[model samples]
Target: MSVIPAELDGAVIPGGCADCNAEQHFRQDEPGMWFIGIAHDDWCPTWRRIQAQRAGLPTTFLS
Candidate 1:
């Protein structure tokens, strides 16, 4: 769920989590469509750190 309205428009959609006030991205694009999800990196430091700590093998490692 999201705390902000879902009608925002911009380079990047904006929103806040329903459980917390952390900023978030509420929209995404595919080949020919748009959908909603919590897919941005706007999470708070606590969540980011937690995610980093639980990371698995790199999906891609390029140089």
Candidate 2:
């Protein structure tokens, strides 16, 4: 039930949570990888789940 804010429409990275406003950057110096500039709200559940996954933490606690 997350909705992307109007200002961020069409700008979010593909497959990212709707509540995420993080910017995706592809730097020439770091080719072949995409960078995320996090701008999500601190309390966003989807963002928290993503972080947990990245850290190898269980996501079962997240809804």
Candidate 3:
């Protein structure tokens, strides 16, 4: 199980994960293998999954 670090629920209302830094999560588990840190479901925004997919478009190389 994951431990809720102190700083996570500190002064910051939308307390983010000290390990990652996500903007949305429960006081529990998170999604994805590359967890950017558990976020505050009630405070922070959604997780960082779709955001990643929308990042810089993929590229292909050929000779």
Best of the candidates, lDDT:
2
lDDT (10s digit) by residue, model 2, range 1-63: 223333343355544447755544322223333344545666778779777779884568666
The best candidate by TM-score is: 2
lDDT of 2: 0.52
- Which residue window of length 10 is worst by lDDT in model 3? 26-35
TM-score of each: 0.26, 0.34, 0.18
RMSD of every prediction: 8.5, 10.5, 9.1
Q: Which 10-residue span in candidate 1 carries the lowest summed lDDT?
A: 4-13
Error of 2 at 14 (Å): 16
| Tens-digit lDDT track of model 1 for 1-63 | 544444642234355444445444444343334454454345566557658867855646523
- Report the number of clashing residue pairs per model: 0, 0, 2
RMSD of 3: 9.1
